[model samples]
Target: MHPLSLRSARLRLVAVAAAVLATLAAGLTGAAGAQAAQGCEVDYHVQHQWPGGFTANVTVHNLGDPIDGWDVEWDWPEAQRVAHGWNAAFTATGDRVNAEHLSYNKAIATGGSVSFGFNGTWAGVNRDPFAFRLNGRTCDGTVGEPTTTPTTPPPTGGESAMDQVAAMQPGWNVGNTLDALGGETAWGNPLITEELLAHVKSQGFNSIRLPVTWEEYMGPGPGYAVDPARMDRVEQVVDWALEQDLQVLLNVHHDSWMWLNELGTDHDAVLAKYEALWTQIADRFKDHPAELAFESVNEPQFTGAEGAAGDALTEELNLVFHEIVRGSGGGNDDRLLVLPTLVTNADQPRLDALKATIDGLDDPMVAATIHFYGFWPFSVNIAGFTSYDAEVEADLVGTFQRVHDTFVDAGVPVIMGEWAVLNYDHNRPGVHQSGELLKFFEAVGFHARDKGVTTMLWDAGQFLNRATLHWRDQHMYEYFASGVTTRSGTASFDSVYLPSTGAITAKSLTLHRNGLEFQGLWHGGTRLAEGADYTVSGDTLTFTAAALTRLAGNRAYGVNATVEARFSAGVPWRVKVVTADAPVLSSATGPSASFAIPTQFKGDTLATMEAKYADGTNAGTATWTSYQEFWSNFRPDYAAGTLVLTPEFLAAVTDGQPVTLTFHFYSGATASYTITESGGTVTGTA
Candidate 1:
């Protein structure tokens, strides 16, 4: 039996329903001389209702007079309780509820309205409240005819593919789950749940790219029948996402490299299997809402094919998928279908090849897909490229521009199916500096929006923790979420380094205000005074010496305080005040396999390390670059006050040859040490 098959019988039965109820409570009719009485109306819509919970949207109309602020007051006729509300500040006293206007939606002009939504729960009965008041004016209790939610399937030929993919902007990938090699949980992610989908929707993502691997759960070649249980599991997840009103991008994941890559050698057999697999998938999801889309493959590539041949092979597979899905009956006829370039690369040739395919297909419901992970060295923290610098930014912008020109400019929509720094997949801190990582995501979201491309973050239990279901780093997630629609002010770095033992001096940082106005500096809830605490000269923010002294209380090591540089829009930039001094190293001798230098870091954090031989050639691992790979060749264990040299780095060194190592710290301090490898032994001197 398949691993995913375990939950086939336990699939939750979701009840889908929608209702729009309106009530007009007329205010008291006043005398002719009296000021016009205030009157209002309210529209409560049940957008989605399940068994225990439902999501609703309320609109408040001020019919009488213009008001600076408004609040909607209502009582739960049943036992329904608000669980989560948005677009309003909600307060509940017993069964009575007040939905007050937020800062952005406070004003309600005469004849204008404001809307808010919330998810609520009920034990047995869920009834709509008939009586409502807006700013103390009664909205009469004359209930309009109740209308059911629109259950019409998405048009098979009316809506264009561009519109379909556009609705899925800022998507997320459910990576390493169904796409895991052996089984769903083989990659350490838990089973998919409706609660997780709800959480994702609440995080502001509009769609989910679900990558499924079918090879492991299928029978022998001729039939290539996918296990019914696996199909049921996939449908269950897809239905859950659809029920949450989220677009679903379903694709043949991992299969691209698993057996599907042999198309060149075993063309007939591979094509047959591919056809069979997609046929089954299409049949299973033929009638699903148009919110569900099908992608040809994940990073399609051919094993023995190269260049144009590989491109041709991918094109063939995509065409086949498009034909099969479109030919199938029901909603798939006009469902948005996505195709990928060779290896899903955004290079000119690959994009051109995919564009040619889309052009020849003569179908308006097709989208091209590509993947981005920024520059490789910076992405994986190798070759001394640690920051999200000019080179990395250029790579990002250049890729998006090419894809835009290739597909988007020509009226073909593109989907960035997968993106994120590769090192982030490890979920390890310090692989990429915190500021650089945030900057990378910020740029990714900005450029994706700028280029009019849809991007789906590739997460495999990294960005969002699977067990806790919470963002691993809330601030980083904020940058990603905010970057989708607005620009945020960032800085050259996220920290201000001050010497622990030296006199305090004013420190300045360059701000990358991406077209937003700078507000002021803030520490927690209190805003710092501009002239005394800090000063802004152009893009540089200078923290006065007095402010630094006060912030660095006792001049302790590591981070002392954190402050936010608020901006006019988007997420605010965070700056850490850190106090550190030069690190010290102590020499020691040990086996070449396990050698560590005892180090007193004092108050500094290591950035990168450079190793070179006496003759000026690169030493140890990664000889191509004098700056060795971080964590791969050396690691700083600040907790243990030691820096360990991995066995691979030592083994690559010439026996009896001394290697000079320069360790760079984040606080502008460097320490030099010499290590000699002899036979199976190693000795170091500082």
Candidate 2:
């Protein structure tokens, strides 16, 4: 008989659960008894007719009193077999159907419930609401009705926080931790809040790629004590995500490896310390459903500082991962584990070394991760130097796609652990630069959604309007937080699995209500709409739904009668052009539009100005000796003068630099001048 059978029948009863299902165990068969049986949860209710060929709908409830999780188990004779399952995640074999972990068992409120199900056929007969066993223990009583709706359905098992991360594709690097997440030390930063957490959630960002300082979390001794406060802070943030119904991944971050980059050192002692750290974390959050995951190390590039030949280090780290995962007190045996590259860079040489598995931990949850920071110049392209040129910008995006395709094709999950704007502080010359940045990001966001690659943005700190912190500028980084924050009623986003083919245009996108709101006029370059013609029905803006017509000159062009829509007030506001049913990051990716600026500012020309509440031709102009100086004072100052460029007869300041000091001359005695910059600023995250 099976080892689990004796525990269920006359041998002894510990915890009871629904019928059993055997899960796959292709790797690691032996381990200490304490860590022998895998962990799981049970159901309080079951829905089905008496056994044979009947489908069993089990509600996997974390009913361990004031509970976070429960492990439900039951033994099945070889004569019976499980056919299918749903709601809660499940895995079964010829003699067992085990479900000890509940996917939907979120903060199972005092007496709240989450249900799951499975269909199986007993060779002879079976009973409904069968007695269940949990973790080799038996439940005190039988399961309730599978159809009884205490509230919601059970969580699908095997699901982890990394699942949602499979959205942000093609990652980048964080350079130094201080420059990351707008934090100080690479160690800690401002506390996590609902809004900051939501910001990351909306940007289609999936992972945190946290670079933890291990020496910081480790205490003296083999205990490898991960600080409770720090851990709590990390877990608290994860908790916020779980609240948003998102995923949270935790890793050994960048600490230990940054200083002690080596992999071999009395592997036993090291593994034990790793074990201790996980034991504490796992025990506390083990039942956080499966949304929480563990990553081995950040950028464990062995061989001193940073070198490619040190990849053999990842192999040893893999050993540590397997040993700790299967060791005593580590409930992470079946949990998802993210493995990084030699240097964690997605660039070619480093990516080539990722062909090997963790030797033993090649389970489905074992995913591959790397970073990507394409075309640095684009982010720091101050003087419009290498900027502009849409094709070049799009080319960089292609590079991102190439790297993503390479890893995804490998079958294992690929995560762009770190990615962001080249310069978090872009202070210059770049057209289509903003659009280029967003265009590629959006394209990749769409592609990542299309494929199943999980992604994580750098972190969230310099990006939110927390409001509590004091500021010298008064406005705070709120400008960065504006459109990026995930507000209520915004566009619902997720990786769109639905597939469609053809030339299509997303039209008349609007944002109104508590959802996405607009603050600028449409910038012409982006061409988010079909053309300059369009109609609006409330907030769901629609564009020229007409079919595209191909033209000559090696260009595929289509004529869209309607092009843009302004999000003024009243109704639903749109944030993006997405395919239906696709999961969208709750981001405020506003339409390509601009808000009016004062005449003192440059960029905006009279042709683009719209009278807020006026009639006739209202204009503002300025006259200065030098174009450069003119631009300096190019703001609105309610002055009655002629818009002149003080032609200077090429006589004064004769510098070949061609400094034309032109000034905007306001016509109608200070017509409340408005400046409409040619380029609309790009800021916002989900």
RMSD of each predicted structure: 11.9, 18.1
- Show pairs that collide, candidate 1: 24-140, 25-139, 25-140, 26-140
Per-residue lDDT for 562 in model 2? 19
Give the Å shift of residue 256 in candidate 1: 1.8
Report the number of the highest-TM-score candidate: 1
Q: In each prediction, how many residue pairs overlap at the backbone (N, C-alpha, C within less than 3 A)?
A: 4, 99
For this target, which candidate reaches the highest lDDT against the unseen true structure? 1
Candidate 1 residue runs with Cα over 4 Å from true position: 1-157, 425-427
> Model 1, range 261-300, lDDT digits (tens) per residue?
9999999999999999999999999998788999999998
TM per candidate comes to 0.80, 0.45
